[model samples]
Target: MAKYDYDLFVIGAGSGGVRAARLAAMAGAKVLVAEEHRVGGTCVIRGCVPKKFMVYASEYAHHFKMAEGYGWTVGESSFDWPRFIAEKDKEIARLSGIYVRNLQNAGAELVHGRATLLDAHTVEVAGRGRVTADKILVAPGARPWMPVELPGIEHAITSNEAFHLEELPKRIVIAGGGYIALEFAGIFNGLGVETTLVHRGPNVLRGFDDDIRAHIAEEMDKRGIKVILGAQHAAIEKTDTGLVSRFTDGHHCESDVVMFALGRAPYVDGLGLEAAGVELDEDGAVRVDDYSRTNVENIWAVGDVTNRINLTPVAIREGHAFADTEFNNKPTTFDHDMVASAVFSQPPIGSVGLSEAEARHRLGKVDVYLARFRPMKYALTGYSERCLVKLVVEAATEKVVGCHVVGPDAPEIIQLAAVAMKMGVTKTQWDSTCAVHPTLAEELVTLREKYVPQGLGQAA
Candidate 1:
């Protein structure tokens, strides 16, 4: 007889949890998934998918301007923010339905309720009593964080509320220097909102390659997005005219909205993790080992809840690996190394592997190959937009350790570069490859000079 009602029970039907549930069930284990919210989790419901749609909507203004440079007569155009939001919502609903149906099709039962761990091998669905499971997987993911220390802080919106704003703000002030902050800054600015990006750091994108950070900041400024650095908003106050943001540096700005994108914190609240003896890290993230196993033998976690690489793809991979290891006896572990990612800011960013700073610290010495130029499309249009491609190579092994690109289609270019870096592609191999005629990506192979010690010079 089966020891429990379910062989596996998963809490939080986000990408990771859903994937794990489907895989385990397909492998013949009886799986049940409980979700308090929608099935698609953050990436599908409120994050990457919707954010990327907004990014596409935001770029039309630039495209129209570039059209003029191309000698094409463009008529006056206006954006219907409401229509875009409605369309975005429709798409999200469609994707969420697919996630739910996939699990059902795989023979995983879906429960619509919040779930809490009752013990090591049991879960209590809110208002639905309890169910026993031999194993449980937690993948609740994370929630946007905003500092509440300041007065009237509640008046500010996080990314969650940004999608539902009644009207596009004429002026918007954004806080933080991370991916979310940069992406929204670009989104609002491109959509013709007067945008001011305020960060408490010396520059934006703190952990990215230094050149990429500086170049993006410069590009954002050229596009007329005011980049405020090294200071934070002291307080947000509602006034007769929109909102007023007082800065710690004694300066202030008034805007229609104040959006904070500081970062995300793992969502483990009310999970009754303590009752199950599931441990958590200091940052409130569920603690797990290399294999996503929690302290309890029957408990495991993956994705943002574990706080390991917070990308959606990483979560999906971890979820799949868990199912393979636990159900298929394959003992698979997601290879976290060399995972590629993209930031959908105005110019966009595609990066993979270690940053130059990391390589310098880890490998002692590294050769940096870099190219920065105006793309060919801009030549006739007189667009001053620039593209940057940089490669970081380990000096001792000549293996490419990192690839970074910014500007047009940076994400697309960097994705291909990630494959090469993952396969340990060397500088010589890149050099041997012929250039794609007159293309921005061709610079990836054609860059021959190492970065000069001072400023932006090239090796002779």
Candidate 2:
């Protein structure tokens, strides 16, 4: 018999924590999982799943426009915020039920409440008292963070509130240049709201490749979404009509809504990790080693709380690794390299591996191949939106180091590229693969020319 009451106790029933708990339980360890909010955590409950539904809803407005060029007489249409919200709520509730059922099927007991570590192996629930475990896993995840300096900041809604708006605003002012902010801007604009994106940085998507950042901004402009660069919200005021935002650069805009998708921070407060001797990094993320183990031997953390890779899939992998290492005696660890990601923006973005700039700086003497063209669907509709395909290669070894795509189905295409890159597929190998005719991805394998440095092959 085990010395502790439970072999494993998991905090936060998000993707990471839930996976760890279920797997540990299946391994025949007595496991208990606690969640204060919804069982599915950020991605399933409030983040990716719900947000992607909004993205799909927003895209219909564009479809109606494109349908005209294709000779489809689409009748006048209207979008009801309440109807969509209700449907989304139903779908979310169903998913939450599935998550709970899965855990139960795996023989893991679910406890509902905010759980805090009382010591290394003891966790105290808000009303449920204490539970002792041989090992503990913390996957508390992150929360949307907002700026505090602006006055009337409380009036500004974060992404969480954006999902449940009573009515769609006529005009919206969104602050932040990250993926979340840009995505919402597209969402509101596509839904017929006057959307204006304001960023303190010179451009949106600060960490992406320069070309991608500029291209997305251009596309947003073409869609009539105003982009304000190098400025921030100085203050906000509630007027009789709605809300008004004053920028740091002396510009002001009035709108029915103001949202800040600035970023997210690890939800560590009140978790009692400090009391349990688990250390956090400078950014307040739970500090974990390569194996996702905290300073305390029995306590481990995964997902956004660890601040490794904030994606939901990454968290799932981390959780699976934890169970394999501790229970199955497999000694597994998650490899963060060559992971692919996508942004569900107006056109969307999908990328993997190093950025072009990062590759150039690190490898030096890199070769670049890029192509821009309209997809066949766009051509028939007379739509002008174009797609970009780029490949960055190490010139010396001919190994493809990075792949970036901006256009329709980009996320799906990049997933294939990610698999190839993980296997160290070279530029030559990519070229040898037969191109799938009449497909957007064909452009990726068909690029014959490499972009050369301007001065290198010239008169000099």
Candidate 3:
């Protein structure tokens, strides 16, 4: 007789957990996946997939203007929030169903309930009886965080609630300067909402390349987003007209909506990690080794809960590696280095490897190549928006250590650039590549001149 009810008990049907469960079940292990909410996790349901759709829907406003600049007689147009919401909801449901069917097809059992640890090898699902497993994998993911103590914070919404707003706001004030805040600022502004972005820091995208940061900020201003720097939300007050967001500096902005995109926190509360003796880091993220193994031998975790690179693809890679190591008799560990990422802001951003600051700090001496130019698509238009492409090369090895792009199709461009950087492509090798004439991406290969900032040393 089997010692446990299942070979593997997976908690949360998010990307990582689902991937691990499917792989493990396919490997002939009995796997059960328990999720409290929908089958698809945040990325499919809220974070990435739906957010990208919003980005697409919001972009048409500018496209119409560009069409006119190209001599196309575009007629009147308007966006219907209810219709878009209904369509978006329908597609989300379909995607969630696909995740469900995939798990079933892979021979993994699904339980629609929250799963909490009873012990190292036991999980108790809410309203369901306890279940035993030889191993447990946690991939509960993360949730948007806001300061609970802030006055009238209840009037504010996070990204989670932004997608479900009944009607588009006339104006919005979004706090924070991270990718989420910037992306939403673009979405709202592109959709014709008077948008204001407030950040406590002097510049946005704190960890990104400084040049990229300055360029994006300027672009945001061009797009009509009021960028407020060196300010924090001191309080939120609800009035008859709208919500008032008062800044620490005593200034204020009144808007129909106030969103706190401060950041996300790992969804570890009430999961009974203490019961299983699973260790968590100082920030409440599950502490795991390279193999995604928790301190408790039989319990493992991946995805945002572990907080290692927080991107969905990274979570999936970690999950697959864990399953392969545990079930397929093959030891695998995902290489977290050189992972490419994208911000779906207006014009968008794609980046891989280290930033210029990181390269300079770590390697001491680095060569920087940068180019900024108007894309051909906007040549006829009055738009002054320009695309940015930059490369950071280690002076010693001449290897391209970083690639950053901002503007149209930046994400797609960076993805391909990541491949070369991953293969240790050097600066000379990158330049030797033939340019696809009359293209934005071609600028990457054509950048021969080393950009030197005035009054700065040679390393920049």
Backbone clash total, candidate 3: 0
* lDDT digits (tens) for residues 1-460 of candidate 3: 9999999999999899999999999999999999999988999998999999999999999999999988999998999999999999999999999999999999999999988887898889987789999999999999999999999999999999999999999999999999999999999999999999999999999989998999999999999999999999999999999999999988999999999999999999999999989999999999999999999999999999998899999999999999999999999999999999999988899999999889989998888899988989999998999889999999999999999999999999999999999999999999999999888999999999888867786535
Predicted candidate 1 versus true structure: per-residue lDDT over 1-460, tens digit per residue: 8879999999989999998999999999999899998899999988999999999999999999889987889998999999999999999999999998999999999988999888899889976779999999999999999787878798999999998888888999999999999999999999999999999999999889988999999999988999999899998989999899999999999999999999999999999999999999999999998899999998999999998899999999999999999999999999899988899998989999988889988987789989889988788887788988998999888899999999788899888888888888999997889998978889989888788647535431
Error of 3 at 112 (Å): 0.8
Candidates in order have lDDT scores of: 0.91, 0.92, 0.94
Per-residue lDDT of candidate 2, residues 1-460 (tens digit): 6689899999999999999999999999999999999999999888999999999999999999998888999998999999999999999999999999999999999999999998999999977899899999999899999888679998999999999999999999999999999899999999999999999998999778777888889888987899999999989999999898999999999999999999999999999998999999999999999889999999999999988889999999999999999999999999999999898887899999888889988998788888878888787677778888889999899999999999999999999999999999999999999999999999999998986545557221
Runs in model 2 deviating more than 4 A are 453-460
RMSD of each: 1.6, 1.6, 0.8
Worst 10 residues of 2 by lDDT: 451-460
In candidate 3, stretches whose alpha carbon ends up further than 4 angstroms from where it belongs are: none
